[model samples]
Target: MMNINEHLLRTFEARPGEFLSGEELSATLQVSRTAIWKHIERLRQEGYEFEAVSRKGYRLVAKPDKLDVEAVLGRLHTRVLGRSIHYMNEVDSTNNVARELVQQGAQEGTLVVAEQQLAGRGRLGRKWHSPKGKGLWMTLILKPRIPLHFTPQLTLLVAVALCRSLRQITSLPIGIKWPNDLLIDGKKISGILLESSAEEENLNYVVAGVGIGVNLLPDDYPDDELRAKATSLAIEAGHTMDRSEILVAFLQELESLYDIYHEQGFGPIKLLWEALSVSLNRPVTCQTPKGLAEGTSLGIDESGALIVKLQDGTVTKWYSGDIQFSS
Candidate 1:
């Protein structure tokens, strides 16, 4: 069966800045005029604005500022990432949805994106601020053949991609915090979370959840603590940004990095990651399951572990935990 809504959207997309009559759309869609009208209504409910005339048909005048499925899909030049997408206006979490889809045999490179997340979560299961149409929230599924223990590497890889995207689109100073937090001048701008579904000793699939503050304003972060540390591209750039552009940019960079990772190895990716890292060569505090330690980040290793030089001149490799810069 044809997806009447998606096809209808494509028709308008092809003829941008133009209007079509009901008869023309009906003839093109091979459906009744009523069906075309219904489809247009559906698009409107999805944040699309149509200018309907008395005799002439509808024209797409405006689109949502967030990541529209058709818009993102059309703009992507990637081969593996973002080929398949499941879009929702609002959801509990894209990661949760992607996991369910994975169980139902969703292929690798499948993406689940939303305009808003009702119960979004960040690292340590903390609440993630995902305002409607104010940021980008999505989860991408991958089924790499790497070991399950190496899944953490994907997080850093994504951070590199995201940081590259921001750098390309804006002039603000952008860098990656250890692991996968993206910061613009020491303020948080983005986060990445990786969840994998694996068998006893093998990996089945990995869900890389990404959340970015694209066009968020100061009003969005009313919390005093959040306002001090959290920021958006718009806030830092002093202008509004299109979330769709950032969405496509991130996907393209991620696809390229993923290819490099598969074709060569993690060495190249580690180097790229180190180049964009803000924690390296700086005083840092690490909190691991074992205990807390202060050190200077030397960079990551081939296996994606943090190499830190402790205060006592002792060197150690941290395999797991979170690290925060002292300064």
Candidate 2:
């Protein structure tokens, strides 16, 4: 059963540029003519433009390129993930809002998407570049049944999903660098920040913060220093991308891979992650709380640890770290 907004939007989409009278819309939606007008006004607030005549009801004059929840919802094919979505024009951080939603009893697969983030972040407290309408800034809430220690595997799994989706949508050579930084042509394009809460023993929930540089130009970077190390979908694809398309594809892939992870375990996901990793066999250094360890990357274990052969002829698995590659 589709909601009224969805039904109304679909009707307008099916008959693009055609005018439907108030009586027609009211009959089709089984609502009063005034109700239709209210819905149209709400959509206008969401950045949809409409043309109204004396007799003709309304016509969609133009659709804003801003984030459209209905656009994403119409194309979403996932079972659990992204079933409920909240869209914002700008947020301090999607993760912050998502954590609040979780505390307010937001269900699993609930998503918070923003067109821009004021305080966007990456792993290790790094500031993520998210300009207005130039990136996908979102936080997905999850309550996976997996144990606390193995929760890190979700980061790798999401990387695989994102890699497959971006490749399918934009045909970009996206690969995962270590835990969850997405790269193309050896420059960063996306990053994932995972935050979770736990009870005395069991895990409570996880908030996966994802930022994808969609249509950012070279000027969106905070400084020349970051511009040399990061790229965007528009830059790599040579044109502006339909951010909603990428969003739907990402959610679908994530849900599919997430299901596989819960049913079959991390072995299969680890293989897919390794296949898309760019850090394997590279000279890398991991900065843990203990200290920094430099080694050759040997890929990740089932527990999502980076297996490394240290500089002193010893092997170590780092569960958490800031990874940097040696050029």
- Which candidate achieves the best lDDT against the true structure? 2
Which pairs clash in the backbone of model 1? none
TM-score of each: 0.81, 0.81
Worst 10 residues of 1 by lDDT: 64-73
- Candidate lDDT scores, in order, read 0.88, 0.90
Q: Report how far off residue 184 is in candidate 2 (Å).
A: 0.9
Count of residue pairs whose backbone atoms collide, per candidate: 0, 0
Can you give the lDDT of residue 182 in candidate 2? 93
1-327 per-residue lDDT for model 2 (tens digits)? 998877888999999999989899999999999999899998888778889998766898887668778888999988889999999998999999999999999999999999889999888888888888888999999999988888889989888999999999998888899889899988999999999899865789999999999998998888999999999999998999988999999999999999988999998999999999998998998778778778898989988889999889899898877789985
Looking at model 1, residue 81 earns an lDDT score of: 87
Which parts of model 1 have CA positions greater than 4 angstroms off? Answer: 1-66
Candidate 1 lDDT score at position 33: 94
